[model samples]
Target: MKKQLFISIAAFGILLSTGCTKLNETVLDESSAGGLTDKQAAESMIVPVYATLPNLFTHTNYFALNEISTDEAILPYRGGTDWGDNGIYIAMHTHNYTSTDPNLRNTWNLIFQGISRSLTAITTLPGINDASAKTFLAEARAMRAYYSMLTLDMFGLIFVKEDPTALSEIKRGSEAYDYILNEFLAAEPDLSSDVTHGRMSKQAVWGLLARLYLNAAVYKNLYAGQFTFAGEDMDKVIEYCDKVINSGRYELSPEYFAIFNDNNDTNKEIVFAVDQRADLNGHNRMAYFSLSGDQFPLPEFVGANGTDGPAITPDYYRTWENAYAPEDPKVDPRFYKENLSIYSNANDTCVPAANFYINRGILRGQQYGLIRRNGVFLKCANGNMLVGKLFHDTRNRPTLPVDFTEKVDFSVEGSNYPSGYRVEKYEFSRKSASGRNFGEANIVIVRLADIYLMRAEAKLRKSGDAAGALADVNLVRASRTARTPAPPALSNMDLDLLFRERGFELYWEMLRRSDMIRFGKYEGTWTEKTDANPQKRIFPIPQTAIDAASNLPGYLVQNPGY
Candidate 1:
């Protein structure tokens, strides 16, 4: 487990500013350096790759396209006034977004930035003549492959470069897919098997390979519904998943929430993650991103208030209700609910009387928490902390109950501030009031539970082995070595059951987009989304990208139905 202090990703950005150019940029300084050591140059070369990861899921990037675009989550226009960013969020959910959508372009640019950095490393790192340089080069290729996979998955096109000076050729469909596969396979032997959560290690490579192979059919066929998970691809998925599982390196965390805590960097279950910390470029948004304005978690920490951002769709929440008797989330280990909880910033038990902490995970029903009255926490006459209905706005005059009711009005004018269930999948950092921005929790990318689920899906899809698939699912359920009070074991499994199970296990982790596409559910109706156009399955090439490519003649083109 590499600690946050080990690398200065900020310095990498500074160096990258000097390195970001066409492959034609002269690799002058390092190639004939008389000052910097070979290892120092190699270190400098690899930092930009890490630099690209933290922002991938931040705010309106890939996470928006993955979760908000699906039935899992939504970012409606709050109060019919805020969050109305030209109706882009609604358009994203409705499948009506155009090439000019800001989030789409931001996601595209961020991913390409990663590709460009990885290409720089791949082309520049080999100038050194040390054994470690080989490892660096392999990691560069692996990082490039990962970025390319995202581009290929999101848009049907990828930029292929032969050498530094050569113009990039845009490859699409199976050709680009095969190129990505080759990159991963080529990097495998040279990658270290060490548990570097932030870096591209052997286990991360295996996990990436499994993910790519699992989605191979969708990548191959693009929008076609006849995407057959080839026997060979399914075998590769199983093979790679086994590599990660059998490595004796990771396991399911005993406390499900432990995997998302501030100390998650030490969790063995995380195979690959984005390292976030107070000292590094960590974002605290995940912890407070979903909570409503009235449900404050850290009243002691100054400026600790919910931004009232995205929330889970009622449809996705119904998955839990449908699974459990009486629909009580407190009975499930996966759902973290806190009621009658008191919180103060900085552990000052005298926490000024006005604040209270809301429990994490999905919040529903009549919400209960503390409120600020005259800069002091309020209390009941009986000496217990005061609890009341969560209000909507900052003024607390509108009197909005925190009861997350179904049947949200999807229209801009009809969208309410407290319409959906808020999620705290990533543990809220109690370390600071402004913890949302300075969060230290490592954002999990790949983990042991996901590996088990992948293997189960592959087994079920490839050989019709329902018993084998059920056993794998049961392993994840029963092996709550880290989480106590395990959820009930699932039996009598089928395809639909497995699909719902995956939702319960991996929701809000950026897996919903590909999973829905693979399950042929991407186009299904839910909430405000009704468009099922197959072309929308793959995002359109941002118009800016197409226009930029036009300068090179036939180098770039848009995906179908853009």
Candidate 2:
């Protein structure tokens, strides 16, 4: 089932790059899709619904809006030229973004595109009489719920339509939240329990339900003082998480990095993921985005310059540093401590002379990597890759020692560009012949580790089961300790401790914004952000969407803050 979706993604990417998707074209040819056999029609109808996923989860879309907006990452203008698209990134981090931000507008449109496609499938797929027809219908509805939930979570509104030509009504707050929850519930019965991880299976539905229930209070009231996790909601979260856990289909990955590798489809830890492939339409942006122009990861490909876009915040980095003993920071397996060295030969075969190949987790301190000079890679006397000091893209800037630091000077113009550390959470693809342009790494959307964490959190919040919560947390910690030294186990648990534990386990996974809001820290001042307006809890509906919806009477409403 997943292979079929992968094939669709490959075909979709080719057509998408050529500007031939129905969302871009003049019209949808229902005859071609409708005239197919039952099996063929089912596949055709589901393509559009899955097609919008790449645009939604790609580096610049959902990941940028969610992670960069939080303290986990930031995309400052390197050398005051690159990544300086009218300060949109800064606006996101600072919470000053308006409805006119182009990136924000793009995300808004892409999400609706998914919702629109899903709605089309819900009405079209039910007409087939094949055995797969019911499963396809349920999957379509589940897709709609998934997309709608994201729209609601981010914009505080969802669009509802009865059929392809029907009008859409804007649902808000608890109304929109409840509608999405019920949609998932309605689809659960018919959803295939044994579908591939990438498809909408009963497990995926349960994971989505657990997530929705976990954040029920926040969705019920957009901005509230001290959210109360309703007992029933918390219980539901536990129940659904248990359902996923007890299924025995997933287990904690012994290697933390294995969960995000290119071969992660067979890792057995991922419950839901975006099936990206190098030969198909996979992305190298996640691992390549933050690297400097001088660093090269692959020996087979050249001229692969990273965008130097997003970097980890010092505040988040301090959390990891402060948790462990300073003498040996790499003792914790999640930190990827063994390979890092303050010095490098620069002539080594590794992409980054610093030996960052296949390494995962946060990066800090002096970085060693091959430096590009005079439009060619600098080489050592023995024909080994020479280590040259990195300099700003701007001419005559001070030479960089490849030293990554925690503090970044976001306001410096053209200088101090390489001050922040780069994230290597996703495995760098050494097999791609296209270098950083394409990759084969599968991006895990949800995994067993997350399910365990959610259940542990629910147990702690619903009942004072600190011991039970600690056991779950330890399970995750122990699973990753097979190759690296394990941290001492905690005797007790608290909300603050649990929150920090989540930072260690789930950073850079696009969960920071929601987590911060649930923890009541979203409004608090951090780094570049201020004004903490309660109205900023949910982004303003894009002005473009609002203007387009104005064609129909009372069809759309802008969010509270623009």
lDDT of each: 0.75, 0.74
The lDDT, on a scale of 0 to 1, for candidate 2 is 0.74
Query: For model 2, what is the alpha-carbon lDDT of residue 136?
Result: 76
Supply the TM-score for candidate 1.
0.88
User: Pairs clashing in candidate 2?
Assistant: 79-414, 278-440, 353-369, 354-368
The model with the greatest TM-score is 2
- Return the TM-score for each candidate structure: 0.88, 0.89
Q: Write the per-residue lDDT of candidate 2 for residues 162-194, one digit (tens) a residue.
A: 766777777888999889999999999998777
Candidate 1 overall lDDT versus native: 0.75
